[model samples]
Target: MGFNPRDAIESVKDIATNAVERSADIVDSAGHILKGDVSGGVEGIVSSSMDIATHSVYKIKEIATGRGDDLDEIV
Candidate 1:
């Protein structure tokens, strides 16, 4: 049997196309999963930071005014 260059080229084209399609699917899935993780982590950090800030401000105000309504007074 004689080797045909045209047949070889066609075979390579099909394999390359299939590989590209499969790779695209993997990348898309990984991006979506990573995006969700990053988003949730950022939201949690922001919420915790806000809570700390609010508590610190309240404590400072009470201390500066010498108010008996400080957190210690309430608890």
Candidate 2:
């Protein structure tokens, strides 16, 4: 059998997508914990959700544009 680069890239993309999703879930859960804080609970939840949502979009955009493994994606 021959190596198919597209399949390899797709595999990697799947892995990365899953990782991002799980991390987002963890972060979102943290927001729930912070929601009980009296001073900044709402702010924490809002900021955390917005950051995760935007960053998720950015990562998907990078993958769709064929720059999934670029250093920019890491940071």
Candidate 3:
């Protein structure tokens, strides 16, 4: 049997998507377990974690695009 490019692409895509979904579920579960770590509080921990993740992603994009400090100073 001959190898088909379309079928190969589809198989790879399915594997990648499944892996991503499983990893996300694990993170979600961990977050839920820690949501009340601060005497049943949920603000400081979750909010700060989300902010850091978002900022890191934004910084990565800016640096990757060659914007560096210029984009930060402008924004």
Candidate 4:
């Protein structure tokens, strides 16, 4: 057995990518169909969703790096 740095790096990348994709999906599915204030503008929802995805990716990066301190700022 031996340490595989590439494997670890790939794992982290996968986690971050998955987190971002999932976050965007969640926001698109739920945040864009409210039929209320801010719902009439798709651009606004998309911008908000990108913000959310960015936050989610940051949180995932924190977790992947084993430094989740102050993660509350994400949610």
Per-residue alpha-carbon lDDT of candidate 4 for residues 1-75, written as tens digits (9 for 90 to 100): 233566556656766776677667656656656655455446665665776666666655564554555655545
Measured over all alpha carbons after superposition, the RMSD of each candidate to the real structure, in angstroms, is 29.6, 6.7, 10.9, 6.9
* lDDT for each residue of candidate 3 in 1-75, tens digit (9 for 90 to 100): 344556555545655555565556556656766765543234444554565555555554454444435545656
lDDT of candidate 3 vs native? 0.52
lDDT of 4: 0.60
Instruction: List residue ranges in candidate 1 displaced over 4 A.
Output: 1-36, 68-75
Residue 30 lDDT in model 2? Answer: 66
TM-score of each: 0.41, 0.42, 0.37, 0.39
lDDT of 2 by residue, 1-75 (tens): 344567557656765676576567566666766666543645555665676666556555555554546546566
- Worst lDDT run of 10 residues, candidate 2, spans 37-46
lDDT of 4 at 52: 62
Which portions of model 4 show Cα errors greater than 4 Å? 36-75
Candidate 4: Cα lDDT at 49: 70
lDDT of 1 by residue, 21-58 (tens): 55565555556557786665555555545555555555
Task: After superposing candidate 3 on the true structure, give the runs of residues whose Cα lies further than 4 Å from its correct spot.
Answer: 32-75
Arrange candidates by TM-score, highest first: which order? 2, 1, 4, 3
lDDT of 1 at 34: 74
Number of backbone collisions per candidate, in order? 0, 0, 0, 0
